[model samples]
Target: MEWYLKVLKNYFGFSGRARRKEYWMFVLISTVISIVLSLVDLGIGTFDEETGSGLLSTIYGLAVLIPTIAVSFRRLHDTNHSAWWLLIVLIPFLGALFLLIVFCFDSKEDNQYGPNPKAIPDDNAEIEA
Candidate 1:
């Protein structure tokens, strides 16, 4: 839950690395929310021919889009890749495949972009008084 909120707080931020837990947790929670909302929309027959509102479904998708892109870009940053790579997903099937590969790959340790986000800070390091 902390991770989910952290990601949301950084919703529009795309300049830093995100650890696997942060990225995956955000994805998991968002997916669960989407599923639950979808179920409710279906149950209410929001799109029923007689009388249904499409507004709720549209809002749901819009709500998730920002975090989705932010996480994906941060995931790429974790791999030391430029966030611009996200544009690749605009292509056909290949784009999504590429993103999947990137998201699944382990973060590079000490890459030019930055240090591995998965590494824990040294407890013995001196702190300024």
Candidate 2:
């Protein structure tokens, strides 16, 4: 999907705002890939205790982790909040809950962060001939 690729292209970019569609699509695709990679690694005996995770698995996680954090931060930016809010996840319980609420909630309209991502486009000029 274009949304998924858009996020990947901006992989390390922590600026700008990301809509719910973009963020959720990336998560969905990443999760499916991780599942498939883990299964393949298991088949090839890459699940050995020595390395813990196979090369593919490690790569898969890193690939997803980078985008996940980046998008999450961007999502926070959409709420007019600093990316540092991500550090809340480091706290035991309360912090995690707070961050979850922030990420799951919709963005406020026209805040300092940016315009509401879900706002409908104006079609007033389109004459209904």
Candidate 3:
């Protein structure tokens, strides 16, 4: 999907705002790939019993860690919050819950982060009269 690729293309971009769709799509695609890679590692016997994670999965996770955090930071910006808010996840149970609530809401219109991604027209999309 375009959303998933767009997130990856942005790579370490932590500035601009990202819509909920962009964030969720990236999460979904990453989860699916991780599951498949884990299964492949299991079939090849490269899965680590000690860490309970496969080598391929571990590698993939490391490769995407920056992009994942960048997207989260942008998502928070979309909600009109600073990237510092992500530190809340370090707290007990309440932190993650708060972020979940934050990410669920729609983006604020033209916030300081950037334009509303939801309203931007895709360059590849053809507009017909």
Scored by TM-score, the top model is 3
| lDDT score of residue 114 within candidate 2 | 67
Q: Write the per-residue lDDT of candidate 1 for residues 16-57, one digit (tens) a residue.
A: 787777788888887787777767777877655445434566
Stretches of model 2 off by over 4 angstroms after superposition? 50-52, 120-129
Collision pairs in model 3: none
The window of 10 residues in a row where model 1 has the poorest summed lDDT is 120-129
lDDT of 3 by residue, 7-120 (tens): 889998999898898899899999999999999999999999899999999999999999999999999999999999999999999999999999998975898999998789
Could you tell me the lDDT of residue 108 within candidate 3? 50
Q: Please report, in order, the local distance difference test score of every candidate based on alpha carbons.
A: 0.76, 0.78, 0.91
- Total clashing pairs in model 1: 0
Candidate 3 CA-lDDT value: 0.91
Full ranking by lDDT? 3, 2, 1
Winner by lDDT between candidate 3 and candidate 2? 3
Clashes of each: 0, 0, 0
